[model samples]
Target: MTIGIALLTLLHILIPIYWLGGDLGAFYSSTFMTDPKRTVGERMMALKILNNIDMAPRTTLILAFPTGFALAWAKGWLAVPGFAVVIAAVAFLGWLALAWAVHLNHGGGAGIKRLDIAIRYGVLIALALTGIAGVAGDVAIPFFIALKLCIMACCIGLGLIVRRQLVPLFGAIRTMTSTGPTAETDAIIAAVNGRARISVLTLWALVLIASFLGIATPV
Candidate 1:
């Protein structure tokens, strides 16, 4: 029990650091990626860096659920079965495998990307439902944990928005890189990047809010 709590606590503490650090890297890379003054190769390199950094936060986000849940159960805040931690660990490991497989394959490998996306949406819905259930007295949950779950759900939702925003940004980038940069391609890149940054900022706000709530627990 002592070891479990210590490990879970450490895992929880590391998550925000992992998330924000990776996101900041990607955010910085985006500037270079969108800069038309840079050579196409340089911009492509930036894009590659951004994509690599992105995997960090994405992995952290998936692990956050199991880590948080296991921590809660370990601390006696949740009344789940004793095997719950094992189940959570298994789930986390499975998701982690799928996530890395998708990454290593460069988003290929027989629907792994699709499965990963489905997992995100499924987790988003599950977290939201759990929060609602706890609040509505269908399940017993501590106030802070329930609120944290909801905050997490919001983070996932914002992440989805960020993902969608990146699509057009990457498309414009591919156009510029593959066919040589044109005025039209540069304009599209700039526009898409600008709009995508808004979503990124929003996601950052959610991360900060979640961090604050976890730390302060004022509510």
Candidate 2:
């Protein structure tokens, strides 16, 4: 039972990191083109990639939370109210973020933006809380816990940097799809493409780190 629970917990933790990291890479690659020569279809493809990438994190979160809770329960760690609350909160927020993103894709831009901000902040808080709990419990695998926290921080930071670059990309896409592109639009597209590539590479590095930490440390 212990071993089974440990495996499940590890799955819950690692799957999200893998899915999010991979999707981020796909999105980044698809968008890393500033060439004004690219067709609208190509740009749309890039957007689709971005959307898919955005979907992974939420899906992983969904899987991670309940499995984590179950593992914690099996290990008798969920006995603490604070831990329970944190798990529940993280799960709820993850679900909410997923729902909001879906809604945004359907045209709820403001709602999506707000939810994105909320989820980022909430995840950060949850990581901090989880790290504290891990330390308090003196889990034999403190390194994994610390690594998870660090990955969360890195993810949040990258998201913030990418967010700033998104506006211009959006505008460029709009101009490309609607009116013919201007020099300004060309610049925006280039910037967006460059940033997207960087974000993809960054996500890849994060995934590598996550994989190392997850696999190196025995649960």
Candidate 3:
């Protein structure tokens, strides 16, 4: 039972990181890389990747949250106020992400942009709180805490990079639609796609590393 509980806790931490990181990559590619300069085949491929990316994050979160709660309860960490707040915040963020996913699937006119922003901010806050609580509680080893902090920093850095790359892509895409593709548009599209690929690779690497660390020494 104890081993099983530890496995669950590790999964709770690792799965979310993988899912969210992969989905962010796909989102960046699909939305920002669509260009008239690209062939229809290329555009279709990007869309397919985006579609596949949607499922992982939702599935991971669905499993992670409950398992997380169970792990906390079993470990007696749920009794801590700071830990409880962090858990609750994660639960709320997971719900919002789910709602946004559903809305997008249904073609509902919901503010997905707002939800995206919320998820990013919520994740940063939750991770920061978790790190602080871990320090105060001495629940995790120093190496594990350091690993989690690095993963959290990577997550935030990815978001910032995506925003920086996407803003120019957004403008370029708009111009392509309204006025047709130009040299500037082509350049931005290529740059955005390159940055997005880098971001995706980075996230995948982070997820793998974090997952290993989480399992090797779960908190």
lDDT of each: 0.84, 0.63, 0.62
Query: What is the TM-score of candidate 1?
Result: 0.92
lDDT of 2: 0.63
**CA deviation > 4 Å runs, candidate 2:** 1-10, 13-25, 28-35, 61-90, 93-104, 107-112, 129-141
lDDT (10s digit) by residue, model 3, range 32-150: 34566676456556756765675565455334444555565556545545567467657766665665575466434457656655665676676666666665765453546555655
Candidate 1 wrongly placed segments (more than 4 Å): 1-3
Tell me the tens digit of each residue's lDDT in model 1 across 78-177: 8899797788789878999998999889878768888988988998999999988876778788777787888889888988877686677666766786
Query: Which regions of candidate 3 are displaced past 4 Å?
Result: 2-45, 48-69, 75-90, 97-112, 115-119, 132-146, 178-180
Higher-scoring candidate on TM-score, 1 or 3:
1
- Clash pairs, model 1 backbone: none
- Model 1 residue 69 distance off true place after TM-score fit, in angstroms: 0.9
Q: Which prediction has more favorable TM-score, 1 or 2? A: 1
Candidate that would win on lDDT: 1
